[model samples]
Target: MANTSYTRSEELKEILSGQETQLQQKMDEAKDMASFLVELVDTLEVTMSNRSAKGDKEKPLRYCTHIMEQLDALGWDRVTLVDQDLSRVQIELCDASQRKHLITARFPPAYPTIPLTIAPLEVPECEDDQLASQRGLSVGGLSLKQGLALEAAIRQAEGQLEIFREFWDVMQDFDERTWVIDPEKPTRADKMRRCALGNHCSIQVTVQPLSPRSMPDTKLFGPTASIAPMRTKLYQNAGLWDVKKLPRENLEVLLELEGGFPSPVSTNKDDINVGCGICYSFRFEGQVPDQLCSHAKCQQPFHRVCLYETITTSAPKT
Candidate 1:
């Protein structure tokens, strides 16, 4: 009986020890799972926070608004952000009619030191026969937010004073008074009359250049044959030669200087070489009528038959 009791007690001890070992293992596994879950939650939270942080939307919005206000203060009607980079923002400024002007703002990669570049979106046309000039900016490594802010500040401040000076020559105005011809004969008596009239005198003048002959290939000799003699005589008569005033009327001669008249019966009908009002070439000998042009400058003096052919061929097409 005594032995039986002792054996039963030993068996009970062994069973209890086995159960305690199993419980410890289960607690360790649960702890490990809880730690893993905590780590996963932390990583997820960080990622979500980053997505909605101020840097993503708030920073860009803030910078853009500041820039826009600056542009408005500088008399700009509209501004748009076309592109953004680490060190620059490409902006387009527009007027009421939607004409755009491009500008760039440069900033440091670390930010704060903002600079600007501005240029017209459309190329300025050369006016008054002047050459077209280009203007604009450059940048360094800068954040988009910094660049936007910088650009706005630049436009609002003293940057608007920038001007582009063209290196082109100034167009000369056409003179008419001194360049005109006098039709009336000048005599020593006319000179005396002009001197007496002085400031109150107005002479009759023509803008035409006198021709020595009515036909081409006519020889013009001496200063008298040229306009020089006529100008000299008129100046002496007017008593205003010292002033040598110029005329204001636009003057141009339609006559073209050619080598000679076209041959009446040239063998080559395929082509003809002739000079026009300006230094331009015209080629139409054996082509269809539709290929020819009938501008006054294009019509070179030709033989009667050639002229007829040209008219006949082109008239049908017209």
Candidate 2:
């Protein structure tokens, strides 16, 4: 009986040792799980902190500051106007001839990431499709369809200013040398110029922007008796037009005028400034009389509105 008790005691010791080993393994697993949980919490906290800091750094004020820095680099003098919001900016670009052109740029809310819209402040009133297509803004060798930074767009505009310099120079020569009757206030965008040629006669010419010295589309206004000679001379001398000469020079050679185009400063105001015969005022309702009587003897100038009113009222009972 004592031997049996010894065996049972040994079995009891073996069972207790196996249970202790299992308990130690369970404790170690719990420690490892606790360490894993602490690391996960730390990772989440760092991620959230970084995201909040990034959100604060990318606010609208930051965008405005970035834009101002770029404009300051481009020279503040070139910037003619800028709105308070920094959404719209007007920049004045000068050509090789010292002639200036104004361009307006509009930024979207997502600017720099999205391309800004750039357009000339004064676009031609009658732009042909070909010229219009060539005017698209190309920034830093990329089409405007792609994203453009502020500095790149400004630089591109500066280069483009040189392309139209000749055209503006020709128009300038016309204004300074001749008495321009139409477009009393001329802008860089004007492609047409009408000059008074004494005796109540005028000639309108539309210049080609790409080829400024080429023969322009010409139309003469006045009595046929007076215009017939000018028309015949223009056609006969069309081939004499010299591309190397200025527009005023070409016209003088083509029409064979007695005196060069009449100087606005030297000409008598009474002869050049013919008021509407109907209204008897130099300017009627802010409009100069552009229409003239078709008769050769009485080439009375009248405003379009005045002539229309007279014609409609004077019509015999239709």
Candidate 3:
């Protein structure tokens, strides 16, 4: 019998080659990751540079002033800073349905990066049975006991006001419980589907309940959202193959429950390399209807000619 050990040299060489290639891939990925993080810091730095160079106390003042100007445009004269630090403010805001609400905002020494603290100065408390009738309490899945315990919490929040800059808009969401995708809701084999909006199940995303404008940003662009643009730029900077990778799910999930805020898609953009699943080649431009998968879940675009040829070869010629 031939020496099997010596004969397996070819297999060993193949294994070694595969490992070398994998090592190179890992090196490339590491380099890319580092580059991406630097680019992200750079973007943040640019945004920061554009901001007024103010001390912590002054920074909150400018942000509040910007906010006040916005509120004043709506004929609101009730916004007032009530705190010595200028971190807290009281505003009279009206919701979409035009119901009046008294909202308060208190920013930590760290404001935007960490959500601002907010409270509804005057939202009415409800009976246990009325928990469901209460916008936030019912949908938040709070037990009556939990809801009652949160009366203090209901009155206040460390919230998403940093992103959602309007009193009425933010306060209304505080009152209305938002639908959270069950993290355990599996859309694809223990992976709950990221929304066509590119939102993850665990992340808190605010939807303007029943609004048509909330549809996917565009078939190709995803959401025309404030957060998505920055994330897309980050993903591109990272040279990540899939730009839609979510990095902020953990923080977002907590903020959602804490503040009843919606999740913004803090992730890479909806840029996918569309390749022919048949011929296995990608294209930046291809025939729209024939090249693209119309199916929502699978949207790789194929060469229309390649697809027709594939069909012809597989089927018996008449």
Candidate 4:
């Protein structure tokens, strides 16, 4: 009986030791799980802190309010349109000469921290080079960079407007005083003017914005015979070009026309000089017939395309 009791006690001790080993393993697993959870919580806290820092840096609401304040200070008359999301705004500015110009400003979410983009709505064809050099911004006189205030940007644009005032003044004179054959509607950005000189002849001139008072690059469009005398006069009287006079007056002196250029209102519609003889239309696809019959008696104008098609159809098949 004594031996049996001792064996039972040893068995009990073995069972208890096995249970203690299992319990130790469970405790170790719980400790590992708790450590992993703590690490995960730390990572989450860092991510949230980074998100908070980024949100504070952006401050989109503050940017919108600042833009609104700036626009209000500029006056409501200058504000043409504003986007619902406050991403874009258009403003109308007048030069010293009272000529109006429209400019657009686009803002990013992080505006004022980053440079906003500004550009003129109607930039001129000749000013493309200047625009490219200025990074597509019409404010050539100002070097816009990050942190530039909206008011400063606007002031710079106004200064640029004044710089081009004389150039626009010259263009305005041409539009008002001369019968511009091309560009039915002239804009402030237009540097070239093709004016009618009667007898199916027109003079195309490119004026330099920087030197509006100087002689422009001129080209005559007409039949060979009609243009020959004008070309000769242009070469002979080239020295007579006056920087003091306007472009129209200088062209008149150079061309030496007996009568001034044909007036838009005074011109007769039935006159053969106006439209293409073949199409009987003044403009074909936004262009007038530049090709003219060489014969002085005919002097009939023909669209280059129309003339080509007629000649091709008339040719005999091989």
Candidate 5:
């Protein structure tokens, strides 16, 4: 009886060992840090800029929160937020010439488990200012994936890695002599349109989430003699964005963009002012209101979203 019990125990140990081996193999097959990020960004439609009147400071449950704690321990501060959301954060660095830049990273809806997007902040509208233009555009063009790898290595498996410092260091090290361009990278101009005919037109695209990864990718051909065909083809490419109508070259589209914002559509009914009555700030950033309250006498122009939100939030809690 004693011999039989010992043999059974040994067999159970062997079974556990086999299970461990199988688990290790599965982990080995798992996607690496970079591939995971590409998948995550593609899944989330990670754009450089996303502004909602509502806010982005979403608090994650596990991974991103761990990273945030690590960042706080490292003394890096949160990005100065308009809505005070912690969904995105940054670290500021200055070169020898005192040129300052901000390294910003944003946590997607599913973060930590999915790699965070680490990139420099961009102020495209303010490029005329020497410092402002360069602040978010890094000199080296080092990929965000590489920075994430560096962050992991620096942590040395002690705790969760922090990406902000790694990003800052990489940009500081970039110089003309050290920078080398890789031809295979997706260029800034052609990111949305991948040219197949070799003219940076006749673009191809694939949606990461909505379509199956195994499915054949689709292409959106650029303009020809008349834009009518291109507009018609856009119907097939409706997955490209939320809108169905291709932007018209006619005055309607032009006027919409030009007059996108008029003023504060809704504001503190009491504050009679020339600027946005909601924020009550004189500085408008050259942006006007896209919407106006319908009453002719109460013609308050407002940012479509700002006014909508102001009115929505101000409504009585029923």
Candidate 6:
């Protein structure tokens, strides 16, 4: 009886091992399918972008339809895409549990060299649910299926970004010595002017509860983007601030900029006293609103309107 019981136990262990092997095989197949789908979608995106750049407007619609059919066949929904100057898409997928999985892809106008960015959506508290199940995965084991799905999205965005970057580089090149030719010499205090194509268009990527990986393995085609966990509103009333003192980080900067008192003068700079320093209150069609010395450096307040009028009126317009 003792011998029989030992043999039965050994047999049970073997059966369990066999089942695990089967399940692992199934998982591997699923992963491969996911990866393939992502690649298909990514390829379509690149082809579409190339067509659009060549002024083939009708091709994009056809490409999109093909992508939609592919996604539909795979049972995906809750995807929203806003294709504008900077091609951005917000993708949300849910499992049977209605657990949200989101990915945001940004394709800037830089064309070819600059890459697209794909970031995961961050749910408020549940960060781990979005990651693949690590229950059976061994050390260094990544879910190829999950990673592939994400890779496809990233590849698509990155490809578009590459296209944009390539075009932008060509436009920036005036000569080897002076690629960025500034017609007017910038003043020392002036904010660095960005390239018209680069600044006016940028791919903004936002993802939530992103997995803490060093970086995605795929080569990015465009400028990289970052998304931080939403921080709690750390606001303090400027009225409570010690104007005579400056906090190292200027914690009260926002409140100072917002203004403690809602003086109609605070809202509109146009009608304020002629020499008053706070002038955001008075805005004409073409005039910039005045800003106060909110920072500790020179807390000398100035009206946005009055300051502009004082400086500009002092200098005759050419």
TM-score of each: 0.21, 0.70, 0.23, 0.71, 0.25, 0.23
Q: Which ten residues in a row are the worst by lDDT in model 6?
A: 213-222
Candidate 2 Cα misplacement greater than 4 A, ranges: 1-59, 121-146, 280-291, 308-318
Name the candidate that leads on TM-score. Answer: 4
Per-residue lDDT over 31-114 for candidate 4, one digit per residue giving the tens place of the 0 to 100 score:
465654464346445644664566544435556777888888888888899877677889888888888888888876545544
Candidate models: Cα lDDT each: 0.30, 0.70, 0.37, 0.69, 0.35, 0.33
List, residue by residue over 161-225, the lDDT tens digit for candidate 6.
33223222222221111211122333211212211112111111111212211111111111122
Model 3 / residue 168 / CA error / Å: 22
lDDT of 2 by residue, 130-163 (tens): 5545765322221332246777887876765666
Candidates sorted by lDDT, descending order? Answer: 2, 4, 3, 5, 6, 1
TM-score between model 3 and native: 0.23
Please tell me which predicted candidate would have the highest lDDT against the true structure: 2
- Which portions of model 3 miss their true places by more than 4 Å? 1-30, 34-55, 60-65, 74-76, 80-86, 92-102, 107-117, 120-318
For model 4, where is the 10-residue window of minimal lDDT? Answer: 1-10
Q: Which parts of model 1 have CA positions greater than 4 angstroms off?
A: 1-84, 95-98, 113-318
Go through the candidates in order and give the clash count of each: 11, 0, 7, 0, 15, 40
Better of 1 and 3 by TM-score: 3
Positional deviation of residue 61's Cα in model 6 after best superposition, in angstroms: 11
Q: Between 1 and 4, whose lDDT is larger?
A: 4
